[model samples]
Target: MAIDITLIHWIYISFILAVIGFMLFRRDTTIVCVVGILTLAATSTLSVSASITSLFNSFIFAITELLPTILVISIIVAMSKILTKSGINEVMVAPFSKIIKTPTTAFWTIGLLMMVISFFFWPSPAVALIGAVLLPVALRAGLPALGIAVAMNLFGHGIALSGDYIIQAAPKITADAAGIPVLDVVNASIPLVITMGLVTTITAYIILMRDLKKNKTYTSTSTCSSSPIEETQEGLMSERMKKILAISIPIIFVLDVVVMFTLNLQGGDATALIGGTALLILVVTTCFAHKKRGLEETTGYLIEGFQFGFKVFGPVIPIAAFFYLGDAGFYSIVGDYLPENSEGIVNDLGVALANGVPLTKEVGVITLTGVGVITGLDGSGFSGISLAGSIAQLFSTAIGASTATLTALGQVTAIWVGGGTLVPWALIPAAAICGVDPFELARKNLLPVSIGLVITTIVAMFLV
Candidate 1:
């Protein structure tokens, strides 16, 4: 049967054009989002006028669906920012310096801290924490700023985000696409996660060690926030807030981990647990921050947090809407009840690829990993994850590869590339904070991360 362009196809095509145009022109992300919204609205209504109206409606819907996650992330960021302003961030990390006395130790400590913190609070907040508190210590300990940045990038954004054991957001997306239980995806993903973690960490250590051997003990006096340790300060929060954060955050996360294991909860359940905890914390902390003007200050902080979240994630909305058009779950929202056989973009793409591509589990893993790396060129780690999940569905049948494994591999590759290691633009934040050339930081990461990814892919193939 000859496939004809339907309203859905036209909408999808418009989204594609917007994406391509955004990429080529490097346009403001808001512009890209508007374009995508307009395209989807126009197609679903089958009229330009309706499309314009739908554009407004789609934004409203997208914002609504995204509100919870956005609020959760915003609150976390706001709390961290508040902690920094109050000096608890410095105090929180200060204790570690006692045990971490050497450059090597600084590297490992930064990497380890990033992994643990990111596993709970997530990479964006983790980055802020590391950059604020640990960067100075790593620098003084004789670890180069670039090295510290690489370690943070690899452990936090790459490894932690890929595994996402606690947050579970990544797995949830892939699990839905696979039409499988989230627990099934979670169970299947463990081996791949371990494999990638081991390979990436080991490769990173070796590279750092090699660099150390070539030069004698070298220490830096220049101060940068990207290093991992900072001078301790006081008066940020009441000693009470400090104590609460010190005791509360870890306890909540640990309890969450235990509950997940005990109940065998996975994916969205896990994400909900973490996000819910964050919400609770946000409320408590905001309340604490302003006991006098309780509602006003709390609202202000929340607004500030949401503003940051939108700024950070806004461009992503349109991109996600475009990609969501592919998944059946999201198609109804974007497509106006388009039939399965009619013109679903994601389904059509997956079906076509499944038919045309010769894929095995091993090939699928590598292909998705490569796709991740390619997408990472755009310099936002999570940006490629949705597309990666969609593509992973294509190979699941031929390769018998679980969607989780494929998604993990994609997450692993994309994060390393875009999370501030290989991509200069993404590395800029770390570089600027650490006072190093962004390109140099990127080049420094290329070898270690690439090697790690290759090894991790092989490991994922066998394990998955």
Candidate 2:
């Protein structure tokens, strides 16, 4: 059966190109996505009223699909805020400061610690966890703030997030779009993720070392001031409570992982376990921190958590909605007035292109990698991951490729780019904390990350 490339498909491709162009100029794609959705609906329905309804339906569909990720992230962030306020976050990483005795040690130690912590709590909160404590230690040991930022960025956002082995948020989105089990994406990403992490981090370390040799006198004192850690006075009772929660939180998450493996839990089951544990920890921590005001404070924490989740997801909604139309399962959300037996625009286009154009394995590899990179231009890292997954499924089906490996390849590329390693704006948290220029940090990361991406892509071709 030959797949016909329709005008609607062309429009979708055009809008995607436009979005990529805007992102290259460092512009937000929210409006472009909105226009794309309206255009898609209008073309498919040929009725203004139907198009308006479709728009709303698309948003609803996106939210429904992504609610789990948003919620888990929100809850974790809220828990981090509580920990920070109660001084447990500082205590958690305080021991790491002792191990940074030299510049080389500081670089690898801080980076490794960030990777481990970020894998569990996420890079955003992990930044907060390590920034104040370990950063000064790294700086004191002769590693420049920019170097520290590179280590943190590469390890936390690039490595931990790209794989997302523990949290599984990235894998969930990609697997759902690929129509595979989350464990498939998770298991498949392990090698690619390791390759990217090692190559990028090592390259970055070499660059930092070269810079350091050029300017031996460039110590932490010359470029930046040591930020003093804040002290919070508390009764012995409260201090003990902090110690207990600090120890308890990490253990609980670790046990959750253990239970997950023991029970053969994956996908929503694993996600539910993590979410439930986070909520429980949040409640316990909130009560311990606010004994007198526990009831009122718990409500406030939940509200804040929900707010943070929605806020972060706000831009992602429209972007995901536009991409969701590329999946056949989501076609109904876009509009029901299309021709009988209508297929997704991207899927149909993939089939048409595959049949009309002879695609070698190399070409398939490059196309998927390019699409992942293009989607990552939005700087959200996550918004385009699902698109990559969906496109991976289409490409794999069209060419008889390894679907899991290709999907993992796309997921890793999208995240490493948008997850904050290559994107300047996305690197703000680490940059701001380390007091380095975000652009400088991004520039420092460019070569290493690019090299890593190329190597990983080639490796992906073999896997597929």
Q: Over all chains combined, what TM-score does candidate 2 have? A: 0.65
The lDDT for every candidate, in the order shown, is 0.61, 0.73
Q: Where does model 1 exceed 4 Å of error?
A: 1-26, 40-45, 99-299, 337-339, 342-344, 358-464
**Residue-pair clashes, model 1:** 14
Candidate 2 lDDT, 343-452, residue by residue in tens: 45554554454445457777787777776775665466777777678777877887898778888988999889877887655665676566554555666788999999
C-alpha TM-scores of all predictions: 0.58, 0.65
- lDDT of model 2, residue 304: 71
**What value does the lDDT take at residue 42 in candidate 1?**
59
Best by TM-score: 2
Please name the candidate that would achieve the greatest lDDT relative to the true structure. Answer: 2
Q: Candidate 2: deviation at residue 214, Å?
A: 13
Per-candidate clashes come to: 14, 0
lDDT of 2 at 98: 73
Model 2 alpha-carbon miss at residue 438, Å = 14
